[model samples]
Structures are given as C-alpha cells and as structure tokens.
Target chain A: MNDEKTYALKSKRIKWFENPLISEDKVYWKPKRAIWFWLAVLSFAAAFGVNVFIAPLQETQILPYRIFLASAVFLLLSLHAAALRNPFLRAKLYHYCQFIFALGIFLSVWDLLTDKTSVLPVPYFPSAASVLQVMVLDHALILKSALYSLRLFFAGFLTGIVLGVSSGILIGWARQWDYWLSPIIKVSGIIPPVVWIPLALSILPGSFSTGVFLIFAASWFPVASMTANGISSTPKKYFEAAQTFGAQKKYLLFKVAVPHAMPNIFMGILTAAAFSFTTLIVSEMIGAKAGLGFYINWAKAWGAYSKMYAAIVIIALEFSVILLIIGIFRRRVLRWQKGIVK
Target chain B: MTEVLIDIKNVNRIYRDDAGHKIYALRNVNLQILRGEIISFIGPSGCGKTTLLRLLAGLDKPQSGSLSIEGKIIDKPHFERGFIFQQPALFPWNTVEENISAPLKARKIYAENKHKAARYISMMGLAGFEKSYPHELSGGMAQRAAIARALLSEPKVLLLDEPLGALDAFKRSELQNNLIEIWQKTKTTMALVTHDVDEAVYLSSRIAVMTSRPGKISKIINVELGQNRDRNDDGFIALRKEILKELRLASISPQPEYNI
Candidate 1:
C-alpha cells in the first residue's frame, strides 16, 4: 500500500516545464542540449568577428557599432534564456536563436559577395552595411513618409469599414433596401478603385484626397459584401424568437443581426486591411509627393539602391505589425468560437 | 366558464411550397385558452400545431381571421405573450443571467426589475451557471435558461414550441417537473406544442389533436387528473393511451379540400 501511494504521488507531480524528449510518458522532438544557447553564442561570435576582421568596400557610419550592439543584445538574451525554468520560453528562445544565426550567415555571405567579389553587380545590389547606413542617415525622411501613408490609410479604412458595416446591416435586414442597394453594389463593387486614378487626379483638388478616395473604394466592397452575407445568413429562428419578445425593427436589426454577423464583419475588415495597403501603395506611386511608395520612386530615380531597399524593408515590417495587431483583436472579440472551431 | 385569456377565430395561414404549389399550414383553426390553464397542441409534423402557436404569439398573421388577448387584437408581438422556440434560441454572446434578463432589457424595464432576474435564475435551478454562455450549457440547461428568460417578463401567456423536444428522456422528465412547479407557483397561462403524447397528457389540462394537409383541430380532450399526478398511475397511462389513439386517427383521416 505504501509503495502504491508513493507511485500515485509521483505520477501526480506537476511538470510545468515540459521537455518532450525527457518526459516519461511520451518522447517527441527535443534536443539533448539547449539549442538556443549555442545558436545565440554562435550568432554573437559571427557578428563580432565579421565586424573586426572584414574591411568594407564602402565605409558607412554606424555599421560596426550596430553589429557590436546587436551581438551584445543576443548575448544578454541567451543568458536570460539560460536562467528560465519554463520549457515553453526556452523552446521559443531556441527558435529565435536559430533565426538570428541564419540571418547572420546570410548577411555575411551578402557582405562578402558585394565587397570581396564581382559575383553581385555594383550600383544595383549594395552591401547590407550600406543599406543599414542609409537607413540610419535617412531616418527622418522615412518617418515622415510612413506617417503620411498611415494618415491616408487609416482615414480611408475607417470610413470604408463604418459605411460598409452600416449599409450591410440595412441591406441585410430590409428586403426593399436590399433590392435597391444590392444591384448598385454589384455593379460598382466590381470595378477596381485604382483604375479611376486618372479621372480622380483630374477631378480632385490634390493627390492626398485622391489617395484616400482610392483606398476607401478598394476596401469598401469586400467589407460590405461579407457583412451583408453574414447578416442575411443569420438563423431566421433568432429573429422570430426576438420578435415574439416584442422587439422592434431597430432592436432586431441592431441587437439580433449585428452581433450574429460579428465574425463575418471581422473577416471582412481583415480583407479590407490587406486591400487598403495595396491600394495605398499604388495610389502613392501614381501622384503622391510624400509616402513610402513615393520615397521608393524618388530613391530609384536618384539611383540610391540602398535607400530603396531600406524603405522596402520598413514597409514590410510595418505591414506585418499591423496584421499582427488585427489578428490579436480578432481573437479577443471572437473568443466564444474558440472551442467550437478546431 | 373561466375568463377567456386568448381567443382565436377562423384563422388560416397559407404558404407557397418550393415548387410554387399552395400549401395550407393552418386552415380555419379556432381555439380559446382560459386564464391560468395549461393547453397542449399535439400532432404529427407539418400539422399546423406550431403555426397556431405562432399566430397566438403574433409572429405571423392569419388571413381572414383574428386572434386577441384580453379582447385586444394581436397584430404584433407584445411582451404579455412570451414565446419559447423548439431550439433554446439563447443568444450565443450572452451569459445565462444576461439571456434571462433580455426581455426586461428589451422592454427597457431592466433597471426596476433587475433583482427579479436573480430570482428567475434560481427558480430555474441555474444558480451556479449564471455566468456560463449558451454554447457551454447542455441542451436541458439551455432550455431552462430560455424558460427563465421568457418568464422574467411576467407574460400573461407563455407559448412553448417543443421547448424540451431535443432533451434526453431523463432531462425531459426533470424539466417537465420544473415546468409544473413554475406553472403552479405563477399561475401563468401556457400553450405547449409537442409530438410526445405522454408529455401532452402529463402537463396539460386539455390536449388539442390536430390533422395535417390543411391542418385543423379534430378534438379537444380534457384531462381530469389533478395536481401531483403520477406518471406510473393507471389513470395517467389511460389518458396517454387515449391521446396517442386520437393522434394516430387524426393523422390517418383524409383532410377536406377548400375551393380556391
């Protein structure tokens, strides 16, 4: 009995930090040693070594300093990982270390190709160090263009989502409204909003307004279409039940229909967000004097390939961050669907 | 004669099927519900039992006829006439307590009657699950929550459309007792639709047998058994058998055609 009790207690012990390969019950993928620790150490060594041993073809401000700072940061992060008791954190740190090591190798190769060999042509493919240097020098210009793009993108996206959702609710709830509006939406929604750029530039007072209009037109149709489908497909029984509770037309439309269509509305908004970015870029490329798209164009005209690459990198990072924020919001709002979905 | 709480006169509801053929969901159906009485409409599928209930709830209008509560025409839904659908129909976004308080909130009387929401939650035996959402609750619990929601408004008449049909036998019997307890305490008039003959005989004071294909009521049987009725008792079984026989007959008999 004592032996059985001991076995039961041992089995019941909580293993908060799960090591998949080391666990007694089952074995899966896990390394014998801390993979992240070694990767982090190797990355720090490589970056510091490259900065000290290799000479750049073109000197740039802050290149060596940035590499030193990055190596120190990685060393500190690896030390922090070593002290963590949680396996999940350790696993995540390991993946991040692997990414950094891969990035360091790629950068080293690119630096060698541009500086020491003629494998990559000059004037077109600048060294990574030069790109970083250009980014540091043109920080103010990049910030200004990013701000301009954000302003136009947000203004148009907000207007489009608000109008799309409202009109969708109206169309979904009332038959007469659907009859009059659906046809108009179908015809107008199909034409790409950017196609009207020439006409818009001619009619609008400035490029700013034209850019905002293009984004709004690009984002509005998907949001409206998805919202309408969501509302129309809401179970009729819910409406009937609400009606029997003496709900008015407004109450049924707003309370019963809108909440039911939230998931679909969120999906529409996500689609609209993606579309708005594409439209914003195209609109900026057409005539905008200040924006990321315009900055790229300006850099290309001046044959400043390093600045162009830096701007492209900034845009990619900003777009990914926006998408991540939207994804988090979607998860929070639709928490009820967690267990129901896979 | 007890005071007539709901009066239905010569009601008919017609619909066009998917093939564009005219179908009579209800044909000249008429029934009177007394104040503080339990009435059950029992029939096969597509027999207008639900149609008549919807008309009483004022969810749909009947052509060439009318229904009234307290001598007032019911052209639209009123809080006095509550409805519980076949499915729980609880809002997926709302917790159990919130769903129960919906009717009061809808009528804009939630502030004054807020305390009553807790009482109804306990009354339905859903005390600990007030915070649970509809998807988390079992079918029986969700149905109970729906009942609490409908009753919180203090409706004079509660119309139930197969509210417990989806529950298992054990849960169905448990909810039947809950229903009896509720009716006894509140003395609220109830109209239930069910395919179960035993359920009809167990809870209702009178059972209305309906025929399909231009649905119409064939007979009304008054259950003489009093309160605290035992399901195992000989008289209860007899009433169940009689109602089942009547339903079987109602389904087999030829329906009369109406000239267009």
Candidate 2:
C-alpha cells in the first residue's frame, strides 16, 4: 500500500509529503542486504584478530583501540543515514546504537580489568588489580555524591515552578504589571543562575541550600517567560466570549488561561530541568561539599583518572533517566495537541 | 410591524491615526431592528460592517450613539446577544462538547439543564462528534460547532458576521438552509453582515444595502416572497435583478466625493 501523504504550507503553495519514510512495503532491499553482509565480515575479522592472533601479545597488554575506532565509524555512518530520512529506521538505529554502546562500555571495562597498563605508567607496569581495588574501595563515596546531587536538583526545580507560574499570570493578565516587571525580569534572567552561588551561600543555611538555590534560579526564567507570553497571546475572542457570559477574572485565569498556557509552561519546565542539571554541577563545584561534581573533582585531585571517568559516566546516566521521564510526561500532557501544524 | 428589540440612533464613530488624521468609520447612522426580522448588512470591505456588528454585540463602543435593547440602554454585553464570526473561533484545545458548553458552564447552567442544552449538539447535527476537537473537524463542521456554541446560550438576538462566508459553496448552501430553519423555529432577531448579494437575498426578510467605505444605508428592500421562497420564480428573479442594478449604480455613479 502507498504511504499516506501529509500536506504542508510553504508560502502560497501546499505540497503533499509522504510519511513512514521506510517500511516493509518497499521492494528495494539491496542497501540493507549489502550493509548486513559487511557487518558480518568485519565482526569475523575483528574476532579472529583479537582472540587468535593478538592473544599472545597480551603479555604487553593490548588496548583494542583499533577495534573501538572501526566500530565507532560504522555505527555513526549507519545511525546518521537512518535518522536523516526514516522514523522507523531511526528508532531501530537508536536501539542498535544503545546496544553497541553498552557492548563497547563492557569491553572497555574488561580491557581495563585484564590489562597491566597504569594511567601513570612511567617506568612502572602497574597491574589492572590496583585500578580495580581503588574503585571498589570508593564505592560508598560515589553513591553518597550521586544522591546528594539528585536531592538538590529536585528541591530547586519544584520551587522554581511555583514562583514562575504565579508571577507569569500576573505579568500576562495585567498590562501595568507587565510594563513595570518585564525589564527587571529580562535583566535578571540574563545573569547566569550559577553566578548567585556565593551570594546564596552567605544568605542560606548550608552548602546544599546553595546548590538548590542555583537549581531554582536556573529553571525559573524560561517557565515565567513562556507562561507570560502564552497568557498574553490567548485569543481575544475567547476572552470576549467569557466576558459575555459574565465570567469573573478568577474564572478566566483558572479556567481559560491556565489550561491554554499549559503547553508553554511544560516546555519552560523541560528547559529549566536541563539548565538545572548543568547548573547543579557548577553549583556543587563552587559550594557543595558532596555531589557527583565533588566526587569528580576529588578523584581528579588524587589522580584517580578511572574513578573520575566512572563518576562522569554515572552523571550522564542520571541525566538520561530524568530526560526519559520528562519526555513521557510531555507526550501524555500534549496528546490533544497532536495533528496540529505550527 | 414587529416589536422593536434593538434601537440605534445618531451613531458617530471617529478613528484617529498615529499622525492625528481623522477618519470616520461610521457617521450619523440610525437603525431599528425588530424582534423576529432577519436583517442583512451588505457593503464593500472595510465599510465598518464588522464594527457595527461588534457594537451590537457590545464588543466596541460608539463615540456618540445611543443603543438600546428592548428600550434599555446597552452599555455592556449581556448573555441576551450571541455572536458568530466568519472564522469559527472555537478553542483549539477543547473538544466540540467543551466548546459548545463553554458559555453554559460559565453561567453555571445546572447539571439538569446540561441535558437540555446538549440537545443542540444533535440539533446542529454534531451528535457522534461531540468528543472530537476543533482541529479534527472539517471547516464546515467547525463553523457548525461554533454556531451550536452560540445557540446553546439561547441568546435573544444573534449577530452573525459573515458566518458562512468562509465555507465552500456546497457547505454554504447546506448551512444557509439550516440557518433559515433555525430562524423560523426560534424567531430570534438576527443581523448578518455579508458581501454575497445572493446570500443576502436568500436569507433576509429585508436587505439593507450599504454604500462603500464610511457606509450609509442606501436602500432597504422588503422581500415580498413567501417564507419558503422559490428560487426559480420570476418575482424572485426580478428582485435579484433590481438589487444587482442598484449595486452597479452605487459602484459607477460619479458624485461629489466626501471623506466617506
């Protein structure tokens, strides 16, 4: 069956574009078959080269850097092609990338575990056992740092939403308030939230409070700005309709404006969360005594490069988890907004 | 003669530009609309047809005019007057049911009245699609939903501003009959603004032909045909010809040019 065509407006002309860029319906399989054949051949060559040939050279402890480089190039090429044209292909490629990335991570860990090349390998062949011993010993510190950072992020993020939404409604509904407050809001939003760390520490109770304050500051601007813009742009007809019905101002705000402005408010919150993650790290480095950022700094100071790498990896994983949850919520809240062209 | 429901007299509206140049959108306008009369306002674009409708709906104010409804001066929009615009301005985020019930909900129309008010959902032929959102509906369906929403409030006077002007020919014909049927059933006063002379002739009891920009009432023709008028009849044809000639005359006649 032919794919359904969707119409898009470009200037005065409306043109139909086909969706589902790839499907099982297509007759051409030449490119897919060719790519699969090369993948099979390359896997065999790498397997034979590492296990049969280079197993003996492990007294010198091989790094498998060539395997890493070759696999990375193949994966990147396939992923870029899949994502550029086809949604189904892009989903499949993303899953494959995740699997490949996981496998690469496992191989890197195995290499480090079995090899005898120390990070500080100048005149010393430090064994892999020593590197493993340090990680096992610092496990508790890593867990504590991760939890501390997450706690700060949630505290500041929630507070930012409360302040942003209330202030946004005021600015949006009242012209006098908008005129008076807009310049201040603009000037203050421009100053990076992280710059307030030292000031927060002096005014707040503790180090964690400073990090939380940073999170709040980082998230507040986008939500407030978006809420204000959304409310102001509500169709005048709806407002007038409400007036004809004798709807009170309170009813107008709660019943009409809030729900209408929700999408933009959610967008603001999403951006705030992203900015909070980045600022949380910076704030931890400046003020907090414990966090993922502090652990990385501590590892770096003591020259434990492997531990530093692992901590950074954990931070990335946490951010990914938060992003996934936010994405799911976004889909649910915006379900009604589907099928509308911007 | 019918009961006078709306009365406007000596209405003058002056608009000032950024450089303080004066423009008269309406001048010395007078009109009286009866309880069950269907009135049509026909004029060129920007002849203040829309402005007059807005004023009737209490959405705008006239600089020097007296407007009364049932002999009471109207200063604010009462729920007694309902409006439908050319564009179906249904809220995009709400379903058809929610949009139609909006004014009802605002008035706190009891849960009991909801079932009665909801009868218009099917009366307007949107029964199965009540749950559908505005974006999902066709242009005709969307406009129908808007009309349903306006009627749900049960306004005594309906001010329709080119309500079917945006629809395709087929949809427009279907809706015009439906509008006539609704008008005959409810006997509500309606003032419709449209540029389509044929629509004005078909729907209106009396067609008030408006002159070009800064419009004045040029002629008000009383259509003498029966309620269910025949389109192919000679009498109907003669009335249509006379209107066309008058419209052409208004367009070509060389006369003294005022700012109007």
> Which pairs of residues have clashing backbones in candidate 2?
none
State which candidate has the highest lDDT.
1
Q: How does the DockQ of candidate 2 come out?
A: 0.48
Relative to the true structure, how large is the alpha-carbon lDDT of every model?
Answer: 0.83, 0.74
Q: Model 2 residue A174 lDDT?
A: 91
> What's the CA RMSD for each of the models?
4.1, 7.3
Every model's DockQ: 0.64, 0.48
Q: How does each model score on TM-score?
A: 0.90, 0.81
CAPRI class of candidate 2 = acceptable
